[model samples]
Target: MSRYTRYGGGDPLAPPVDLAEALDAIGQEVMAGYSPERAMQEFLRRGGRDQAGLDDLARRVAEKRRELLARNNLDGTLQEVRELLDTAVLEERKQLARDVTMDDGDRAFREMQLEGLPPSTAAAVSELASYDWTSQEARAAYEQIKDLLGREVLDQRFAGMKQALENATDEDRAAVNEMLRDLNELLEKHRLGDDTEQEFRDFMDKHGDFFPEDPQTIEELMDALAARSAAAQRMMNSMSAEQRAELMQLSQQAFGSPELMQQLSRMDDNLRALRPGEDWSGSEEFGGDEGLGLGDGTGALQDLADLDALAEQLSQSYGGARMDDVDLDRLARQLGDDAAVDARTLAELERALRESGYLKRGSDGELRLSPRAMRELGKALLRDVATRLTSRQGQRDVRQSGAAGERSGATRQWAFGDTEPWDVPRTIGNAVRRTAGEGGVSGRVRIHVDDIEVQETEARTQAAVALLVDTSFSMAMDGRWVPMKRTALALHSLIRSRFRGDDLQLISFGRAARTMEIEELTALDARWDKGTNLHHALLLANRHFRKHPNAQPVLLVVTDGEPTSHLEPHGEVYFEYPPHPLTIAYAVRELDNAGRLGAQVTFFRLGEDPGLARFVDSMAKRVDGRVVAPELDDLGAAVVGSYLGSRAPSGQADYRDWFGGRGFWAG
Candidate 1:
């Protein structure tokens, strides 16, 4: 309820502050191909809906379109059609026109000058003719047409179309020639097939500059629009992927390159500014600039959260509870069919994933994790957990013990051959006692090495942890996995960013137990119910920790299932639910090894009265570990405490995690 995408007043044509712009900024930046919805969200977060210039442009375009709709047989705004035609022309031609043209209308209408007519007159004709239908001479001949039109009106009329068309396509450029033919056909009929004066006027206003008055046909109008988009498409196809990406990057930074990206960027605002569903009435300069080479249309998923708006509304019913009931399918369903994604959106997401390192395609054409993406997911969790704990506490990396380098302190009586800070009183007393006693120092009162034992700092014990999460359907079955996943990400982020010195491994177990690279976390769509192999997960985790003895080894297992799978040496898996004895035994094999390695096994169960309690309790005693009950939002917090130690509630000896890890999730 806090967020609504307003139809805000804005400069529809200003250079977009979009994902490309975000990526160019310093620090962690949004990558290219970010979800359009996310892109807009981030843009708004940084302050969008603020450009008056674009708003003015949109209004003007819309107004011009309205005017055209009132008079011409055209289909779109002046700027829209001009922009479309401009797309048909070479970039070199656009530059030439911009160089010569001054006014926005002139620059936009310059495409009409393709006929080689004077740019000024051609632009004017394109603008006026786009909305009305009448021969230059015939219309003028109607003096009462003059009386009907008014002196100011006649003056506004464009110069002549033939004057430009004769030379514009004299060379018969295949594309331009085809366009000319279509225009000629549309003009030959009634007001471009517009039966009503209003429709005719709209058509004229939208395409008067380009379409001939002689041919009035609806097919022609459609053809013209298609040709323009086609031309743009062709232009894109002509370039290599690298070239296109490079050009896109450069164009997005239109302040510098201004031609390609800047022009494309303006298209959206320009189109919006026009007559909307009507014809081209806006001035020529309006839509053609594009500002940046990126296209308009806001992409299908421009505001993805919008697709989830209904779900968000439904979620509000949860008030302070039922948060765990949130469903991704419901979120997806929130979108109406028209706004749903297609091939284009998928390609965009894939590109973004590749750029973000979330999806990598290997030689075998399979999805794999890139190192950077993997690191990012882990880093995300690490940061989340660290922040959660540190707000109320201090950095808890680790503390060294007195085992390494013991410090020296003197005992009472000084003995010979000992290094110590001599205690005068104790030495004197010892001498006096010797004079008066049976058991005392004889001649020289000196401290001996045996009596003066130096205290050494205990080597700070390091903990090597392997986090095993159940990826089986059952975990998500209880609708707890996302929080679990987030918990994992938060924990990973915390360790990497805050506890830079800790050793951590991330592993998820389902039918198979294997270590996952960090990049795979976000894109993971685990098969929820394939099988929950708690035994295999633990075994793999234990094997990983066995290599590191210097560290206090531990297994942080996040699951909501009992043992279900174990492997025979031959590589086949044996899976049985309801606590199969073989699976239980296999789990014990690893739990027992963990106990022998002196590593504790901390169990994290996320269900009410979990059936696996007895099995867990037994394992806990075997390794002297503990289990935590996770509240929905407390998953990350609980997991964090496993590595970071916590103090007792009682005002007694403060038990720290030893290493400076925030026991954020300390249970």
Candidate 2:
């Protein structure tokens, strides 16, 4: 057996929305100092590789509105009536000319009646309603004018009535009048809050054939009626004063009865009372040669209203805006299903990002990136670094799996340059066995170099690492701010994930220096103060090193300028331009202190200023460290490789050798 269900209606073959792409883009912006909320909104506004964004949808809607207004005018009904009246008069004159049997006085009277008609089409139509025509074709044509006017007036409020009621009989007209009476009564009851669902259902059952929209409830019915009525009113307002006056007079003669107009007036009043929020007062100006009948003109106004609504929803600029506020059904009706699909995808992406725990509010109630988000962003940055390294190193494998200094449960024969602890029990056992196998066992078994054994250890070293980044305004002005953040995040990810035993500290120095977490550092915006305080940064790094006394100290400094600020003994910051002698002395003294702490330091210079380079080289020489001036794009790889090289044992291959000498200073 098989089962079936109604189709939900979209392209079944379209690819699912790519949330990863959105998340990555949002993460990048967040790292560049955008709040999590703003970053996600920016992503939605820009959309993904294959999806249309909000801005694109808004532009298309505006174009459609402009086209509608420019291509139509409101004179179709009046023009049609005038043509019919001219044909009737021409046929009557021809009949009078051929009728020799008629009396001369009667022919003259008929000619005079045709010649003395009013200038306005509606007035002429009303005056001719009582005239006795001599020609059969003339009488039929004159009658059709009233019929056409009635259908057009009805079509304005009830769409499709002009086509549906063409050449309708008196019974058809009576049924329509009865339907209008019942509809007005229902709306009046609804407005006074005295209507019930059963009454509405009964009303629909009586006249349901007239409403093809198949509204299921009273409110839906009211909404549809009210919207059509409002569009009709706006269409009338868009017409010139002369057109408006003519149409108003012609409407009173609809179906050759004044009763129809009175019922329609009552319906309009009830709808306005019930649905006051509709755009009843709105109007537009149309300047074109193509004339639209009352029905078509109302439809154009409705389209314009829909486009305006879509533009507002797509803007998402109002207070407390959300993607869910967009009306997908309305958008599809106006701009097709593909545009609706694009907007739906964007809304889903936004909802997923907000609910995925990737963003959280800090204590201050401002949105911030969560730790999980930081890890994700860090992983992406690390992958980019790996790709850069692979390309620059000619496809060499530069993957490091574990930390150093953890002991494995195995023993190996000692070799030159081995720093592992000696396996004393294994060495003694090997000596005893060797002596027993060679000859009789001596009272004192001698241990020989061949019998020496050392404990084999896994690479699980515990090291204290300090990554200091320059955060001066110059960094942002020179396009180095984002790269600096990326480099720090890459190294931070590497240590936290691959080398769990390593301790990492991120410190930023501008007018001063302070320690921060990875998320904090990534979200830190550049300050505009004018100082590069390497002295303050070194003080913080030395403190971190002292805290992790037993771990190997590794310091990586990234800067583009010489020292311009120092801390005084009284705990105040002293800043000066062009490197004050006292500031340089203070910075150099801190470097010497870091050297005494046994830190293997590396200076990753950012720019090509000769004076700054010379000063950094001198500082590196004092600490027996290395200085690498890599390209901005390669900064992450250089810092990460230097860190790995610092952790390598005395005789093992390091990241520098693995990277194939890609501008790393091998000290």
Q: What are the lDDT figures for the candidates, one per model?
A: 0.46, 0.85
Write candidate 2's Cα lDDT for 63-143 as tens digits: 888888888899988998899999999999999999999999999999999899989998998898889988999988888
Q: Taking the tens digit of each residue's C-alpha lDDT, what string does model 1 give over 339-366?
A: 1222123223324544664445667564
Error of 1 at 212 (Å): 11
TM-score of each prediction: 0.42, 0.83
Give me candidate 1's TM-score against the actual structure: 0.42
**lDDT for position 321 in model 1:** 22
Model 1 misplaced regions, further than 4 Å: 1-384, 390-459, 497-501, 646-667
